[model samples]
Target chain A: MGTVTGKVLPQPTRDEIRVETVLQALADPVRLRMVAELANSAEPIPCGHFDVEVGKSTVTHHVRTLREAGVIEVRQVGTARASTLRKDDLDARFPGLLTGVLSGVD
Target chain B: MGTVTGKVLPQPTRDEIRVETVLQALADPVRLRMVAELANSAEPIPCGHFDVEVGKSTVTHHVRTLREAGVIEVRQVGTARASTLRKDDLDARFPGLLTGVLSGVD
Candidate 1:
């Protein structure tokens, strides 16, 4: 809604990421897939790049949840928001949590 | 409600344990602490053994959620149901997930 330029959206700082919140975000199957795909990607992926079969608005909601929970970071890239997993930050905070989750992310 | 002897509760089998379900069950602060306490203990703990501040019914609900998610095993111990983390089964199914979550538990 702001300028058309790239905007780094609000996300929880590493220290603000809570275990309960992160787990809550990942509790949904669709969101889990989104995180799994992001983990497999070598680069930031636009919102539509996730393989989830949900509608656009639902995808947006899932993305927002993940962002708010500090599981991922989104940066506006042109007209689309590109999301990147906060792997480094998560690893630093919870050690092997993401890896463990990803291991079971099928 | 069943017999007072030792009625094992209905729970998902090891192969049926889903990542999303596990995350959902652990997403709550009280449940997470319950798991943390169970993880640290050497013996199965009665529902009353957990340090959660919730009332009796709430504690029962949380324990049932964990048991249903296959994160913990509940067995009738005298008049109480003692719960033990399904560590071995969860490890076989999701690898380091429990360890990672436990690492972050408060």
Candidate 2:
């Protein structure tokens, strides 16, 4: 069966994203870890790769929240969802936020 | 008449602060504006100085939320509650986070 390709999640555009949503999305421990890890890596990571304490579905939920907040972009890569930080967009919107916050985390 | 002094609202110590809570507190527009203002000022400002659109109770609620989240310190200064961002504590915890985030905001 043919599967839908590209972004499976509907997300706010970079311009549409709000500061409150970005901060709220990052407030969750699991989600923050995800973002911190993404901030460290140069390449997009697959969803299954994160070692968050929560369950798989919970991870999916967190990822969706991040995507919707415009902090991260989730692309349908084959059958897997690849996620990456919207660094440029966020930096443009909030300046050095990602770098500053991510620097404190592992 | 004699009144209470120092931290009218119970708050987390500098050490007890958490990243998630900081993000959650800053996620709010009013709270974020308060923080942005505090970031700009060298001196602590009274709670009433904030120009939030909400009512008194609501502003108090937001201030309490920010205080408890460890983003700000509230000290009862001469019966007026003065709030200041825990800049050093937050900077130590999350380097450049406040400056970076605060820079983009007014």
Candidate 3:
């Protein structure tokens, strides 16, 4: 039996990045760590590289939340998915919000 | 019968303003409205002046959340409390975070 793969979606529209959604996405420690890791990285990171201790499903959910909040951008490279911080979009939407938050985690 | 008023508390410490608490506080529409109003006001506004449509207790809860998030500062004046946006603290903590959020609502 073959497993089905889901399609990779486009980035969320600005209207979709509501305050509630963004807040909810950043509320979790695991997600915050993921975000911080992404911020510190100079290039896109493969989803498989995150050392998150949560279940795979939970990690997927957190990544989806971050993507939906316009905090990260995801792209497909063959079978692997690469995620990059959408620092520009976040800066446009919330100004220095991400920088401050990233600093707080240090 | 005289009402026994609970003492107004001091501001939350810097360590207390976790991402979760701040996100949770700003997640609600009512609280966002209150923060917007405070941001626009040139001076501290009395808590009684908020035109929120929710029940008084609910409004109080929302205000408390904002206060605890370090998004707003509350000072008692006579029998009423005045709430002001803690723009500097927010800015210091999150850089352009508040400005971006405030502009997004416009």
Q: Model 1, DockQ value?
A: 0.64
> Model 2 over residues A1-106: C-alpha lDDT tens digits?
1332576567787678777778888878889999988887777778889978878899889989999999988888778998888888988777767876786565
Whole-model lDDT per candidate:
0.86, 0.80, 0.74
DockQ of each: 0.64, 0.52, 0.46
lDDT of 1 by residue, A1-106 (tens): 3323468899988888888888999988899999999999887888887887989999999999999999998999878899888899999888878887887876
Ranking by DockQ: 1, 2, 3
Tens digits of lDDT, candidate 2, B7-104: 55688777688777788888878888888888877777887888778888888899899988888888887779988778888888777678767755
CAPRI grade of model 1: medium
Candidates 2 and 3, the one with greater DockQ: 2
TM-score of chain B of each: 0.91, 0.86, 0.84
**Residue runs of model 3 more than 4 Å from their true location after superposition:** A1-8, A14-16, B1-8, B14-16
Candidate 1 stretches with Cα past 4 Å from truth are A1-7, B1-7
lDDT of 3 by residue, B4-81 (tens): 233555778665666556656776777878888988878777777887888878877877888888888887767777
Clash counts for all predictions: 0, 0, 1
Give me the overall lDDT of model 1: 0.86
Scored against the true structure, residue B46 in model 3 reaches a CA lDDT of: 75
Give lDDT: candidate 3, residue B61. Answer: 84
